[model samples]
Target: MRYVIIGASAAGCQAAETLRRYAPGDSITLISDEFRPLYSRPLLTYLLSGEVSPDRIWLKEKDYFNRWGFTPLLGEAVVRVAPQSREVYLASKKAIPYDRLLIASGARPRLPGVPGEDLEGVYTLRNLADWQRLEAGLEGVRAVAVVGAGAVGLKAADALARRGLQVTLLARGAQPLSRVLDATAASMLMQAVGAMGIDLQRYSWPVAIRGEGGKIKSLALNHDRELPVQAALFSVGVTANVEFLEGTGLDDPGGIVVDGSLRSADPHIYAAGDCVQPHHLLTGEQWPYHIWPAAVDQGRVAGANLAGAGLRYRGLLPQNSLSLRGLKIISGGLGPHDAEDCQVMTELDERRGRYRRLVYREGRLVGLTLVGDTENAGIYMQIMAQQLPVQDLAADCRGPDFHPGLLWG
Candidate 1:
């Protein structure tokens, strides 16, 4: 079997590795638009702040693909995928035929349609190339503005502040991390962010970026306010890089729709990671799980199935964990929209800056959020994943005594 994988990030790399084990003699081709080898995308923020060295950012060891016996086509972009002929055409006008293909093109940073976005000093932290370009532009920068208050934007703010740059974080939402954290938890996080000396701007979005000499100079906000900054980093959100599969006849609504086995409409073409939307076991609603761990799991399952190992992906739930300015936050499962039929329990200890919220649907734990103290987060996630009854263990779900032995036994 000749395996061809597109995009060469976490999902594509993991799938290639797993495919090698299952089909030892099969030839594998890993295509990437990046010339650099696989590296930890999450560590890009650390790299920005000089917290980690470039040598330490690589996800795989040197000569990984050479040892694994796969062809690495670096610095090549996949232009189109033709399912009819089982061929993938690259930007170089070369078409490679494959018996099986995995599209893990991943996500690209979504920038607002504001003016001056193409200025020299504005950057998005999606890949190593982005980091390199931003680093080269930051030589004389004194202050920076980060757009959006999502996890990526917050991390960028922290890194910029650590580098002694004045950072102003702007969020269009009412509060920071509003999607994952409830009002109570968001308040606590906002307080922590403020204490770190970073200017937090809520309900504010850049209307237009003003630049001088082809470099960013300031951002004009909604309130007729102009914030001066030498550089700007936008982390608003990401869209799947699925433009290449447009005419392939595979389902693409925001992302490629996949079945439980991560297979697309064409059985031979499978997809995973941020580029594909997999169904939820509980809701049967298809959505993209862009988290790193979920991408790895999806890649493994897709790889196994491609190797004829008929494995079914159980399902995936939304989960996130992050530490910012000494505050640790963890969230899982449902959010506010699906709380109509759920019982909500909250605990707030403002003095200690800790908050916890748990939601139960039909006496089973459906979602959880914890801030400051996330020690027992694993227990909550385990219970939710297994759909264990938490009505009887109410105290455990509400308070600190989360003993898993009672449920397992």
Candidate 2:
């Protein structure tokens, strides 16, 4: 079997490893637009915080490439895909015929159409190159404005703050982490961020960027609020790198569309990760979860199926947990559907800056938001995933007695 995988990120690496194990003698080709080896995207923030080093960022070092007997093509762009023929054409005008192809191109930073957006000193911390740019620009940088208040943006801002750069975080939404965190939980997070001395500008849209000498100087939010920024970082969002499949049979929210088997509409093509819209087990909706876990899981499923073992993807239950500055924050699952008879409970201790809430749907834990009491978060999430009825869940939410034993029916 000849295995061809594009976009050498988490999904690609896992799929390649699996292919090597299941079909040892098969030929495999891994393509990546970036020259750097596959590194963990989530670790970039920690890398910036000096918590992790670059050598440790890679998923596999130089030895893994040689050991697996796979072809590694880096610094090459995939220009086109012919799914009908099961061929991938590269920017270098080389075409590779694949018995099976995996499209894991993943996502790239969304570039806004605002004027002067292409100016220098504006970085998006999506990959290692962006991280190095931000690090290089940090010298003598006093003020920085970060666009988008999503988790990655907040984490990037936190890192910048630790580096002593005065950060101003701008969000088009009314609050921080509105998508992931509930309104009440977001309010508590904002309060904690305020104590960090970081300036937050919510409910604003950036219209244009101003630059002098090809370097960013300032940006006007809707052409009214203009702020001087030594450098700007935009984490607006990500769009999948699917332009190469324009004429191919693969489809996407921005990348390729696939079925439960990770098979695209074309039987010979499979896709996973940020580019492909994988199913969510909770919602039964097919959309790019764009998180680490989903990518890894989908990649493994796709890998097994590629190696001649038919394995159906089980999807994922979108979960993301991380801390900003010094505040511990976590949110997961869909909260109670109509708060009536929902057995909702919340406890807040303002003095200690701790808050916890658990909302149930039909006696099953559906959503949970906790700050400071995270020791039992994983169990609550697992219970929520199984839709198990918690006898004392409401009472536990009312107070801080979240011992795992009490989580039973």
Candidate 3:
């Protein structure tokens, strides 16, 4: 059997490994648009902050593909996939036939449409290329305007602040990480961000990016405020890289919709990672997880199914872990926004810089958010994943005496 995987990130790489392990005799081809070897995307901010070296970014050894007995197509972008012909067409006009194809092409950073966005010093930190350009552009930059207060934007601001650059974080919402954290949790996080000398502006976004001589000079915000900055970085969101699947009838505006087996409309073609919208484990609603772990798990499942393992993905559980300076945060499952039929419980200790919020639906722990203290995050996630009853242990969940043994008991 011939297997072809598009993308070399977490999802694509894991899928290839699973396929090789399950079907050793099958021919496997791995293609990636990035020229660099597989590396951790989550660590890019650390690299920018000088916390980690470039050598540590690689996910595998130099001869990873050679040792795995797979054909590597680095720096090659897939232009189109002919599902009928069972062939993958590359931008180089090369065609490769495959009995099974997995589209884990992932996503690219979304750019907010604003005037002067094409200015020289404006950037997005999604790929190594973007990081390289931003690194080069930061040579004489003293201050930077970061658009969007999402995880990517916050991380970018944090990294830049670590480099002694004045950072102005612009958010379209009332607080940072509004999608993941409630207002209280967000307020606690903002305190830490404020201490870092980052100007956190709420409910503000770039209306226009003004530049001088083709380089960023200032950013005009919605509230008639203009801030002078040497550069601007955007981290609003991401859009799935599914334009290549345009004619394949598998492309979706949200993401490629896949069944439990990760198979798309065409049975011969499968998709995983950020490019595919899998079902949510808790709500049974389909949405893209976009997180690294989700992509890896989806890829493994897709690859197993490709090898005829007949596995069904259980769906995704929303989970995220983030650190701002010394403050740590871990969130999973649903939030207060999904509180229509849910019970919300919260405990806050502003003096100690700790907070915990738990959401319950029909006596089952459905969602959680922990800040400053994340002692039992794994246990919490396990209970949420298994949909275990937590009504009896509800009182103890917010206390320090909470233990995993209690759950099993």
How do the residues 269-357 of candidate 1 rate in per-residue lDDT, one tens digit apiece?
Answer: 99989898888755779877688888898999998888978888878888988788689999998986677787787878777777888
**Backbone clashes, candidate 3:** 0
Most accurate candidate by lDDT: 3
- Clash count of each predicted structure: 0, 3, 0
Reference-based TM-score, model 1: 0.95
Model 2 has a clash total of 3
Instruction: Give model 3 RMSD, 1 decimal.
Output: 1.3
Q: Per-residue lDDT for 319-401 in model 2, tens only? A: 76878756887767753333445556787887777778777666577677788667788887788777676775646446545
Models, CA RMSD each: 1.8, 2.3, 1.3
C-alpha TM-scores of all predictions: 0.95, 0.93, 0.97
lDDT of 3 by residue, 237-286 (tens): 88999999888888896799999999999989999999999999999999
Please list the C-alpha lDDT of all candidates, in the order they appear: 0.86, 0.81, 0.89
Top-scoring candidate (TM-score): 3
Candidate 3: deviation at residue 93, Å? 1.2
What's the best-to-worst order under lDDT? 3, 1, 2
Which of 1 and 2 is ahead in TM-score?
A: 1
